[model samples]
Every structure is written in C-alpha cells, then in structure tokens.
Target: MARVKRMERVVALTKQLVDHPYQLFSFTYFCKKFEVAKSTLSEDVLAVRAGLEAYDLGRVETLAGAAGGVRFIPCHSEKANEEFLTELALQLAEPERILSGGMIYMTDLLFKPQLVMRLGEIIAQRLRHLEPEYIMTVETRGIPLAVFVARAFNIPVVMARRVGQITEGSTVSINYVSGSSKQIQTMALPKRALPSSARVLVIDDFMKAGGTARGMAELAEEVGAKVVGKAFFIATQEPEKKMIDDYTALFVLKDIDTENRKIDISPL
Candidate 1:
C-alpha cells in the first residue's frame, strides 16, 4: 500500500476533532487509519499540535489515564490570543475603518465571521469552567461574541438592545453611559427572556470605561439573572482603571496611532 505523508495525515486527523474535543478515542484506531505506529502517531499528533499553537490555530489538548484519550479543543493559548489580536490591529489600521470621530473602524473587525469564531472560542475557553447556562450581551457590538458563546454552549443568547426591537417581548429599560465615549445610552432587555435563576456570562467586543458593562450588569440584575462573570474581546482600558471588575478579555489594544500606523496588541 502507498504510504500517507505523515504531516498531511496527522494535521487532517487533528482538525477532525474540532466538534467534540473532550470525547475519547484510541491510538490503535489512529494507527490503523494512518498506517503508522503507536509511537509514530503520538509524535505526529504532538508535532501538529505544536504547529497549531505556533500559528494560533487553536489547541491540541489531550486526556490520559484509565478513562482518557486524545481530543482537540478549540481554545486559545495566551500567545495565540496575542497573535490573532495583532493581526486584528493591522486590519484596524486601514483608513476606511477610521470613523469621523476618533473611533477606529473597530466595528468591522468585531463583526467579521471568522474573527468572531476565534474570539468566541477564546471566550468559551475562559468560561468553560464557569459553565454558564446562558450568554448575555448589550445590543449592537456585543451581539457577535454573545452569539458565538451561545453556540459553544448550545444555548440561546439574549440581547439587551439599546432600543427595544418591536420583536422583543416583555421589555425593561435602563440608562447608563457607554464605556467607549461616555455618552448616555439606554439598554433594554425582555423581561420574560432570561429566567431569573439562569447563570449568565456577559459578553461584548470591547470595554473602554466599562459603563456599558455596568449597564448590562444592571439589566441582568433587573431580571434576577445572575451575572456569573463577564468577557470581552478587547479592553481599551485596564479593568483596574474601570469601575467594574471580574472579567476576562482575549486581548487589549493598548495603542493605535493611524498617522504613524503603530498599534499594540496583547493577550490577558
């Protein structure tokens, strides 16, 4: 039989486990599929996992012992998060993305499907231990991450829209300043939506002064739903500097200067 190129087969196999990373599978099965030894298969998977980390393309997490086997979870290492966020900073450097105000065209990056998918995975990894029953976000920008987290948990995401959509049922409204600009923004949530007992992870794309987070926290409280924690894709300001605390971010865009075209991206 013609032999399969080791790199080609191993990477292919690694990508297959994206859907169910925590499931158990055997080395002998892989050996038969790849026509390689137990030792060679082990080495090949390790190499591929390492390459994945280098590229910031998720992770190759393994399980061991009597009830254990190998699986690949879509997760971000600290380096991976920083690498992806750096790429995003370059995209944000485009002149067209800059708005009339000082705001960079960050909304585009926040809305991109592929970027959102990865960002969602990074958020999911952070909250996986929390085991949130639902994902929550304030309307507009936060919707993307909330959707992705909802998908990861196979649950529905509830949005606190700034203006109540006619489609939303049984609503309650609250007023607070937006974190980015300190402009007062009113956020609304459907009263009947999230059950009071639900444990929710609040998600969004960015946190500047954290006024939006505060608004969401208030909305969550009004519903009697517990805000177990919060997560954001980027934080323009440090959490310590903000009024709110206990949140995780995949990256922070430390600086952005369009004229000199310099930007800083870091993982947290």
Candidate 2:
C-alpha cells in the first residue's frame, strides 16, 4: 500500500473520530492502519483536534499512559445553542401552530431528522457530564431524540412501552397520573432492557406537568437503576410546579391564546 499524505491522513482521522463519538481508539491502531510512525499519527491527531476546536464542532480528547486512547466528545457552543433555540422558538410560535385546545402542533418539527439531530446534540452536550449509561424514553415521538443522544454518547437507547408487548417477554409495569390531564396512565419496560445500578438519562419531547418524566424515573428505580438526569425538547410554564424538579429544557412554552391565535414561547 502507498503511504498516505499528511493532509489525507488528517482528514481520514477526523472522519473516523467524528463517526464514532466517545469511542476510544488507540494511537497504535491508527498508526498501523495508516502505515505511519507514532510521531506522524500524533501530529495528525493534533491537527484534527485543532480543527474541531476552532469550529466548535465538538472535541477530540486524548488520554495518556498505557491504557491511553483518543475519542470525540460531541459539544455545542452556548452561543450556537442560544441562536438555534431562538430560531426554533420563533418557528414554533407561529399562530398557525396553535391548536383549538391551546396546544402547539409540533409533530412536523419533532420528526425532522436534521432538526432533531441538532436538538439531540445540544441535550447530549449539556448532560454528558452525568455520564449516563443509557438513554431512556417512552415509545413514540421521543424515540428519535433519544436515539440521537445515545449516538452522541455511543450508548444504547431503552424505550418503555405504553402497553406491554408479548415480544418484550416479562416486563415491569407502573401507573402514574398525567400532569396535564390528571388521569392515570400505564407504562411498562422489559425486565432485561436495563441492568441493576445503571445510570439512566431520561429524555422526552415535551413536559406539561412532568408526569411522564416522573413515571420514567420511577420505572428506572423499579429496575434498580438511578435517574441521573432528565431532559425535554419543550416544557410549559403554566403549572409552575412539576412532578420532577431537576430537568433541562430547550424551550419554555409560556402561553397559548386560542381565541387570538397566538403562542408565547421562548428559549430557556
């Protein structure tokens, strides 16, 4: 095989690191793959790290010593996060998005792959310090967000079902009151989906009273797992109180005037 040029090696290294966020790769492994000296690979890695830092794309972290390796950590700048959330809040505040019941129609926005991918990155970056072992969410709209966050951490996503499926085998079920409707709702998860003592990060699309988010945390406790953090795409400010207290949300929904066809929302 021909020896790869410095520029070509640096680009390839960047691609590999970005494609597998949070995954550690040893210097020896890359040195062998590119048929280059350890010194050459070190310089290439420095170049990749500098480029990533310059653009605020993410981070390239290197560990030293015998059990050392390099990995990519997905991150977003505060300014970038603020700008994106501001634009998203504006888009969501459009009068046409308001429903008859004072609810904002956001299905279209939640399902967009590109948009949700960015949302996931923002959430993941903020919560990455918690070092959650798995991303947990209920079935449906929250799945995409959970998957993308899990991708950023190189972890698995575990989903609870609204109704237990036979395919899941034996499962644990729990009933909790809806924060908004005040009605009892049941959610279940497979016994084997999560292991004991695992750290869980609960994520969801929206929160009104945080009933669903609370239910997920309770379910995690039932499985002997700890709820390290909770995150949401949007949370309402009306209730003033929620079932869960510690949570991060990208946007706050302050009010929806059905009569006037107006929605009041802002980035948090």
Candidate 3:
C-alpha cells in the first residue's frame, strides 16, 4: 500500500478499537489483513496514536499481559479542545431532543455502557497524561461513568452529592450555577474526598450551560485540590458560553427534534 493509504488504514483501525473498548483485537489479525510484519504494524500503531494526539482525539494503549491488546483513548488535545467542543455545541441544537420538562433526554445514550465506557476512555486518556490524583463527579448519574474512568487509570473515584448525609460525614459545600436552570445549586463533598494539592479531573454525563461543572470546580478549589481539567460525554450549546472554557467533550448534539424523532451526533 502507498504511504498515505497505509496511514489511513492505521487511523481507521485505531478508531475501530476505540469505538469498542474492553474487547481485545489481536495485533496478529491486523498483521495478516494488512500483510505486514508485527514490527511494521507496531510502528503504524504508534503513528496512528501520534496522529490522534496531534488532533486532540486521544491516545493508544497496548496491553502486555496474557490477555493483552491495543486500545484507543479519546483524550483531548491542549490545542484542539475548543474546536472539538464546538463540534459538540453543534450537536446539541437538534430540535427533537428537548424533553417535556426541558431537560435533554439522554437516558438512551447514558445507558449504553459500552459506548459510555468508550467515551470514558477518551476522557480518561486525556487526563491520564496530566497524571491527576483522582476523577470527580456529582452523585447518581455521573458516578457510573466517572467510576469507569477512575478505574481506567487505576485511580480513586470521588463523588460529590446534592445533599450531605451522615454516612459520608464531615463535608464541604459550594454554590454553583446549575447548567440547565441558570440558578445556583449546592454540591457537596466529604472533607476527606481529596487532600490539599491533589490534582482532580472533573467529569459528568452532559453539560448544558456548565453550571454543574463550575460548581464542581468551585468545590475542588475550596478543598485545596487542584482542578486540572474537565470533560463530559456531551456538551450542549451555550448561548452565553458560560464558565466551562477549559473543558473537553466526546461529541456534541445539536438540533434534536423530538417531535421529528431526529438526532444528530458528531465529534466535537
């Protein structure tokens, strides 16, 4: 194959594996299909990973244990995060996606663990390089995928709650604007959730106007934790472009016409 053609195949294959994480795809299979030796295939994999990093897509991970394999992690690039987020902004505008309560209906997308996990991989991969001490998210919905990302890097998971409980003990709370309502909402964390100077990566399922994100960031600050980065599965369009300036997203949904049963999703 020509240089350009071979490079394209490398990129395509990387995306395939990323689109399906936890499932192993042996290098041997690609070696045979591409009619290339293991060494050359390895080099191609590196190239693909580098290309992704160059574009803020993610990174490649090669497992070495008995059940080892390659995987793609969609980590945000420092350079292209804004452009990537703009793509997500576009996807949130679809007319059909708005719910009766005005809350975006994303239950279907959030329920798909495979896709969510992969999306988590992208968020995890980007923060992994930053070497954050832990991944943080709000209680309930954000926990599932936040836990996944924490597990991905073998790091601990810290969850903030809408209300404090005796079970969690001593806590800190911060008032942040709710992304959906543009009203202040309280988010709390256990005093021991993290230590001073520890690095934190904030994550959540969806971002409408970034109130929740700002809240979490504020909480991190109160605890003396360093808010290193933030990311989400889907970031909706921001009419005012409120506080979530330094964040990344897997994709954006725009123009959701629920009455039309139409949805549009694309990389951000």
Candidate 4:
C-alpha cells in the first residue's frame, strides 16, 4: 500500500475517533493501519485533537501505559451549549405547542435525529464524569435520547418496560405514582438487562413530578446497580421539590397556559 500523506492521515484519524467516541484505539493499531512510525502517528493525532478542540467538536484523550490508548469524548463549549439550548427553548416556547391539558407538545423535537443527537452530546458531557457503565431509560419516548447518549459513551442502553415482557424471562418490577396524573403505574426491567453492581445513568425525555425518575432509580437499586446520575431533556418547575434530588435538566418548563395557548419554557 502507498504511504498516506500527513493531511490525509489526520482527516481519517479524526473521522474514526469522532465516529466512535469513548472507544479506545491503541497506537499500535493506528500505526499498522497508516503504515507510519509511532512518532509520525503521534503528530497526526495531535493535529486531529487540536482541530477538534478548536471547533468545539469534542475532545481526544490519550492515556499512557501498556494497556492505555486514545479515545474521543464528546463535548461542546459552554457558549455553544448555551446558544443551542436557547434556540431550542425558543422553538419549544411557541404557542402552538400547548396541549389541551396544559401539556406542551414536544414529541416532534424529541424524535428529530439531528436535534436529539446534540442533546445527547450535552447530556453525555455533563454525566461523563460519573463514568457510568450503562445508560438506562424507560421504554418508548426516552429510548431515542438514551440510545444517543449510549452511542456517545460507546456503551449499551438498557431500557425498562412499562410491563414485563414474557420474552425477557424473570423480571424486576416496581410500582410508582405518576407525578403528573397522580396515578399509580408499574415499570419493570428484565433481570439480565443490567448486571449487579454496575453504574447506571438514568435518562428521560421529560420529567414532571419526578415520580418516573424516582421509579427508575428504584429499579436500578433493585438490581443492585448504583445510580450514578439522572438526566432529563426537559423538566417542569412546579412542585419545586422533585422525588429525586440530584438530576441534570437541559431545559425547565415553567408553565403552559392552555386557555391562551401559550408555553413558558426556557433553557437552564
């Protein structure tokens, strides 16, 4: 194979690292792939790291040791995060989003691939310090966001179901009240979905009374897993106190005036 140029190597290296964030790649692997000396590859990696940081794309981390390697950690600058959240808040605040029961319609934005991907990056950046081994969420709406966060961390997403599936075999179940409806609900997870003593990050698209988030935490505990962190894309401001005290929410929902068809939401 012909020798690859420095510029070509840097671009290729950036793509691989960015595409597989948090996945470690050994120097030996890259050296063989590029057919270049370790010293040359080091310079190429430096250039790639610099470019990524300059653009606030993410970060490239290098670990030293026989078992250590390089990996990418998805992140964004504070300014960038502020700008994106502000724009998203504006969109979410539109009057048309108000539903009949004072609920704000957000299913569209939650499912948008491009939008949720960025939200995932921001959430992952905030919770990365926890070093969670798995991303957990309840089934349905929150799955996409959780999946994206798992992708950023290069980890698997474990989802709990509203009702236990026969296929899941033995399951752990819990009954919790709905913060909004004040109705009792049941959520369950397969015993095999999460291993005992693993660190878990609970993610959800929306939180009201925090009952669901609290229930997820309980589910994690039932399996002997530790709840390292909890995150929500949007959380309501009322009730002031949430069932779970520790959580990160990108946006706060102030109120919704169904009578006037208005929404009061803003980024935090």
Local distance difference test, each candidate? 0.75, 0.92, 0.74, 0.91
lDDT of 3 by residue, 69-173 (tens): 677655565545556445444545455557775456666656667756655665765656677778899977777788778766657889999988789889999
Winner of 1 and 3 under lDDT: 1
Give the count of colliding residue pairs in each prediction.
1, 0, 21, 0
* TM-score pick, better of 1 and 2: 2
Candidate 4 weakest lDDT stretch, 10 residues = 96-105
The alpha-carbon deviation from the true structure for residue 222 of candidate 4, after best TM-score superposition, in angstroms, is 0.3
Q: Model 4: residues >4 Å from true position, as ranges?
A: none
- Evaluate model 2: give its TM-score: 0.97
Best of the two (3, 4) by lDDT: 4
lDDT of 3 at 86: 53
Off by over 4 Å in 2: none
Error of 2 at 197 (Å): 0.5
lDDT, residue 268, candidate 1: 61
Residue-wise C-alpha lDDT for candidate 1, range 1-268, written one tens digit per residue: 5977876887677766666444446776677878888788789878877887897666766666666657666676677676776776667656566554445667766778887877777678767888788888876777887887776665679888889878877699898877667688788998888899799888987787788888998898888888888888777743358858887877676766666655555666
